[model samples]
Target: MDSQQPKQPKVLWLNVIVFTVTFAVAAIGTPLWAWHHGFDLAQFIMLGVAFTFTGMSITAGYHRLWSHKAYEANSVLKVIFALGGAFAIQNSILHWASDHRIHHRHVDDNDVDPYSANRGFWYSHIGWMLRDYQRNRYADYTNCRDLQKDKIVMWQHKYYLPLVLLTNFGIPLVFGVLHGDIWGALILIGFTRLVLNHHTTFFINSLAHIWGKQPYTNKNSARDNGFLALLTFGEGYHNFHHIFENDYRNGIHWWQFDPTKWLIKAGSWVGLTTKLRITPEERIEKAKATMLLTRLKTRLSVSDENQRRIQLIQFEYDALLARMTDYYAMKKRFFDLKKRRLLKKYERADLLNQLQKMKSELQQQRKTWYSLAASYSY
Candidate 1:
């Protein structure tokens, strides 16, 4: 299967036709009825539940658990996400993760990145889905080998298109029929929810790259925006994600609106998942300091006064990094001894002191550096 790419489906026509009809019907049929009857509170309730459940399924299950291996979930969550992703009407988890991995690997490269943000916001957000610009449809498989190995991912991939049509239309139809509110259910949950979910997810690919601050790293197009993060279940912290993609948390800050992160944390509590890996605080601070240095350097090259300030910063920054390193290294050494079955009361006290010192040093550096950036107009 690695030797050849999957054939581009002639399903483009099918997609166009089906989407057109689906949208048209929901757009016309439901609203017309609603105009005569008016919107019901129950319909919104169903839409809310569907959107939240299915959205989390994609973020927590497909992106975090399956794609990034940030954590592991039990079969129950796996099945739930599989079904929710299907109901969400995004592609299968395998394909979504596959394409996402490729997007990361060749970001902004029009020829390789499946949804290259270089094509502009609208194109990246929605156009890529409407057309095929990349030659290797399966290019992302390289980064998603683990997902391909999963039985659920494989089954979801195999049954995606059928499942998409079925769940999107069927569930609403069944519920609407049962509730005697067919038009409202179809319009509210089926189409509106899909459009909203699709666009919201798409923003992470498009707007996220263009609209946020790069706090952790500036090496990539990824960014962090509070508004986008809110809309995307904490995925708006694109910069952090690009810098540390393997962490189960996207919005690691105290108030980042990352429901996905919370869900994973909740899962861990319930014993449904484990091995959640987060980048160390020291590492996070280091990246922030490096980016500050890089930005200062950029500004310094043009301003002599700023250059003097930056020169002063270079020496102080190096000293701080060394302090952090020594602190962390000693801490690691102490912990490793205990990890190797050599725990001692004395060692525990030593480890606590070392860890506290490292944390304090990092905090001090961040406070001073951010203060410097705030004052440096140049």
Candidate 2:
């Protein structure tokens, strides 16, 4: 008897039809209608504002809060995110989180990752949604069980269709009526904004994985692209996010253009968000140092150099690694002592003294490590 698995269906007609119609309306219909009807300043401004809110909703609310649980949001913020996500029309928060969790868990695995770039740019970008090949992938939302408990998430999933219709059509129609240019608002704010949002977000899965540098880790296909971050509200820092998924911020640096991180931070000030998780600076630095050393070692191994030169480089590298390990260990102990000072005021003085000594030692180790690493031309 044959035990081969049956091939899953290839075409998802509803998704294909909806995507095709929306793209056609935005690409062909909107421009022609805009030329004929002439959109007003109010319509354009509405498009910009709506686009920002909907996009951030997905980044800050859906991706960070629901998918990764990077931070906790107040009820009001969660509801707003849910509504904004619905307006974005990506899908319900539950479904989106489930798929995203799966993507992270099985990144680059063609068989498991929902939008694995290994399947090609088109498949990762938009082609995956156009087929039912991964039909059973999200059936069990085991990864997103925490999200399933949220009332807002379950509510949005239950009435996602209605919410989508109301936000996608109702909001535009209401605004269009007020602006006295229903068609203009509908074409510009409705169709055009949706297409822009969809494609920009999709670019994170496609171009983000293909382009840019991988400073954090090369184990995955994720890359960090500042240009793409500008387009996707800072989601283009894919390399860092892939390696450190729980960090609230994608762009770890101050000037990395991550509006989502800013929004969440602002929310915390107003009591709308809490527990914004951050990866320790030492761990991040260690990862970078490790990657650099690994690359240098790989290069040295392949070079057809004399034994004396290879041995010298290897000795220097070993010394650098030792300093790095000591620096991180001392840094961790310093932080642990600092954290303890908050709870035990009686030990504050001694902890401070130890922290100072540890800081000085860590600095010396780091200096030695960098000097040794810089000596190598590669």
Candidate 3:
């Protein structure tokens, strides 16, 4: 269903009540309470708790687990994350994920992309939500059938309104009542924190497309901004994500501080997630190869080394792909033979040893290509 000029009933109410009440309370109630009483730190604590739960839930739970399916989570983890996301006051998992999949599928398409970058910053930031946009809001359940089957996701989707209100307002008020500072809680934790969270998440949708290096595919508008990545729990690498959506990590390098990736990896230790798919190193090398060719093409008319550089990168990429295929084939055969379980114990153990050698060669080829790329680059 497409959004018309008619008002969005739910967003209308939420915007009026939450936004108005929050700001009004912050502006009027805070000063009134402070004037009557002494300084208090209760609201700040509520704000901290709100930031922690909401931020983690968005990055780890909603975006990665539910939207991207980077990995699966246990029921306890799922519920906890859903609760945390609710506290953030964003849409429910179903609503957010469906929109996101559509966004990725038709990014920059004026009609379909919810926050299409081509429409300009103002439209992409929060303007899309302020209007009815009833034209683009009906989420296609086909893309989210997996999420549909999940009980927690359904629960969160069905009871989204109350959960959002509870986490956004009720939780803070409870803290305020306990600490005897109702206004402070409403202001700092409820309003200010919500405002800040809104921008941080929206930054990925707006600022990310507007600035930074398009080091991967230029087909999309997404760009990688390291500084933004720091603010967005590593989602600032928008260019890489648009290119490599299936990778478990956004910040693929060791230095990039993607806490969401770290969280999921850590959870794997406790058996909460499995088959955590990662893009093959060879595939990443191909992306780098594409980036090299793209840069070379752009620099061709200006530079003398353009042709040589592109040629070297292509050759190195092909060689790396060949080596990677051989390694995987060898490893798979050894594993398959061993898994038959009919093999003698000693023979199965020998197969494992052979597979280990192939892995070492894979590592060596990876390094060889990396050195080649680095050494050639000026």
Model 3 ranges with Cα > 4 A deviation: 1-45, 136-140, 302-317, 320-378
Residue-by-residue lDDT tens digits, candidate 1, 1-378: 468877753335555665576667666866786788776787778888888877888889878888788999888889889988998877788778888887777777887788888888877886677655544667557777778789988988899988877888898898798778887888878887776777788899999999879877877788989898777788888899988899999988886799999988998899998999999877987888888878777766657776688877887678668877877787787779888978788878877887887878867875776677667645
Candidates, ranked, lDDT: 2, 1, 3
Residue 19 of model 1: what lDDT? 59
- Candidate 3, backbone clash total: 6
Residue 252 of model 2, lDDT score:
93
- Over 115-227, each residue of candidate 2 has an lDDT whose tens digit, in order, gives 99999999999999988877666676888878878899999999999999999999899998888988778888888999899999999999999999988899999999999
Cα displacement (angstroms), candidate 1, residue 39, comes to: 2.2
Return whichever of 2 and 3 wins on TM-score.
2
Model 3: per-residue Cα lDDT over 153-237, one tens digit each: 9999999989987887798798888887776777777777777677789899999999998878889899999998888788898
lDDT for position 34 in model 3 = 65
True lDDT of residue 43, candidate 1: 78
Which residue pairs of candidate 1 clash? none
